[model samples]
Target: MKIGELSRTTGVSIRSLRYYEQQGLITSVRQPNGYREYTLLTIETVETVKLYLNLGLTTEQIASFLTCVLQNKEAFCTEVMPVYRKKLAEIERQIVELNQIKANLIDRIAFLGQQEQGNDE
Candidate 1:
């Protein structure tokens, strides 16, 4: 398939796909005619890339995970678990901070409402 097919199938933009190639997140072979040739596996690889990217993993981190998985499937599964666990912990902390901000906004709204009612009296 061509890059357009990959983009259409993966729902990723062509620019993103090109960037992924530039970032070393993906690879393509060139034919004698200078056209980029992609394998059938490219589709699945793009999907995996999207999944890891959405999980907050950088391209380098995703590459490390891919290398580890290719080298040692079992240990990769075991060792990489903790990294994701840490990401989840950080997300939890962010959620807590966001919740506090939300509560502060609610309190400010209530205070402003009270002041408005006071002005009417």
Candidate 2:
């Protein structure tokens, strides 16, 4: 379909889609009129790119992973495995830090509650 249709369908802006193409994360064909045409598979790839982006993966990492997926198709143990594992570990570490902050907030709230009750008494 056209770029606008793809953008509307994927909820990604045309600028971002073009950026994806420029980043080599997606493939498109140029029509005779200079308009770009996209395939359904491209939409799927864009969704995958969005997922990685949401996880804070860099453009380089996402491009490499997408390339790996495109080349090996059947090879599951390629470079993407190690890359994704490392990313997952980093995410886990961040989650731990976030949880610590949440716990600290809870403790502070309880302490403030106690102080307010004391003041009231």
Candidate 3:
């Protein structure tokens, strides 16, 4: 199919599809007329890319294991384990930081509320 059809089918923008091609996350063939051609399998590849992006993995990271995933060998792909672990660790750290910020905000709000009540007296 053409780039447009791929874009519509994947719900991804044409520019993004082009970028994906550039990033080596997907591939296409160039016609003599300069238009790009994509395989039907590119659809599944694009979807996998989207899934990884949604999971907060970079295209570089996904590029490493995408082929393994496409082959249905993700569990056997040891390289993917470290990537998943690293991302999970990062998210856990962010969650801790956010929780601390939430606690501080709650304390500040309570303090300000008390001050307001004192002023109203």
Candidate 4:
């Protein structure tokens, strides 16, 4: 299929597909007419890229995992575990920070309520 067909199949925009190719997350062959020809597998590849992006993985990170997966699906787990662990730790840290912010917001709300009540009294 062509780039347009791949984009339609994957529901990804043409610009994003081009960016993915530029980032080495995906690839395509150029036809004689200067059009990009994509294999059927490109659909799944694009979906995987999208999934990784949604998981907060950068294009560079996705490229590493994609390289491993393409090289050997069996080796993917062993090779990608460290990346996953690191990302998980980052997410955990963000969660902790967000929880602290939430607590502060709640405290402020409570303090404002108490002040309002005191003013009424």
Candidate 5:
């Protein structure tokens, strides 16, 4: 199939598909007319890429172990553990920071409410 067909089949835009190719996350063959041709198997790879991206994995990170995942050899993709741990740590840190910000905002709002009550007295 051609690039358009792949995009339609995968529900990913042509631009993004090209970007995936450029990132070496996916691949295609150049036809004689300069059009790109893709294999049916590429559909699975694209879906896998989408899954990883939704999990907050970057293309660079996905590339490290995508082949292992596609081949159903995830247990052998040791690189996935470090990346998953790193991403989880980052998310945890952000959650802590956001909690702090939320607490501060709540305190500020209460203080403002107290001042408003005093002014009304």
Candidate 6:
């Protein structure tokens, strides 16, 4: 398929698909007419790239995993798992920080409520 067809099949914009190619997260072959030709496997590859991006992985990180996968190596166990664990830890820390912020907001709200009640009295 051509680039347009691959974009439609993957539901990713043509610009993003081209960016993915530039980032080495995806690949395409150039036709004699200067058109980009994609294999059927490009659809699945694009989907995987989308998934990795949605999971907060950078293009470089996704590229590493994709390279390993293309080489028939154990991407998950060797390349991807460590990065996944690091991301998970970062998310956990963010959750804790957000919880603390929420607690502070709740306390401030309660104190303001008390002050307003005192003023009313």
Scored by lDDT, the top model is 3
User: Please, what are the lDDT tens digits per residue for candidate 5 over residues 31-106?
Assistant: 9999999998899999999999999999999998998888877777888899999999999999999999999999
lDDT of 3: 0.95
Per-residue alpha-carbon lDDT of candidate 2 for residues 1-121, written as tens digits (9 for 90 to 100): 8999999999999999999889888888999999999999888888878887897888888877686675566267377777778899998999999999999999999999999999998
Task: Report backbone clashes per prediction.
Answer: 0, 0, 0, 0, 0, 0
Candidate 6: 10-residue stretch with minimal lDDT: 68-77
Q: List the residue pairs that clash in candidate 5.
A: none
For model 3, residues 1-121, the per-residue Cα lDDT tens digits are: 9999999999999999999999999989999999999999999999989999999999999999998889976788888999999999999999999999999999999999999999999
lDDT: worst 10-residue window of model 3:
70-79
Error in Å for residue 11 of model 1? 1.6
- Taking all chains together, each candidate's TM-score versus the true structure is 0.83, 0.77, 0.95, 0.88, 0.90, 0.85
Clashing pairs in 6: none
Lowest-scoring 10 consecutive residues by lDDT in candidate 1? 67-76
Task: Please give, for residues 1-121, the per-residue lDDT of candidate 4 as tens digits.
Answer: 9988897899999999999999988889999999999998888889888888998988998887786676677354575777788999999999999999999999999999999999999
lDDT of 6 by residue, 1-121 (tens): 9998998898999999999999987778899999999998888789888888999988888887786765574544488888899899999999999999999999999999999999998
Candidate 4 clash pair list = none
Model 4 TM-score on a 0 to 1 scale: 0.88
Order by TM-score, highest first: 3, 5, 4, 6, 1, 2
Clashing pairs in 2: none
Model 5 misplaced regions, further than 4 Å: none
Better of 4 and 5 by lDDT: 5
Candidate that scores best on TM-score: 3
- Kindly indicate the candidate among 1 and 4 with the higher lDDT: 4
For candidate 3, report its TM-score: 0.95
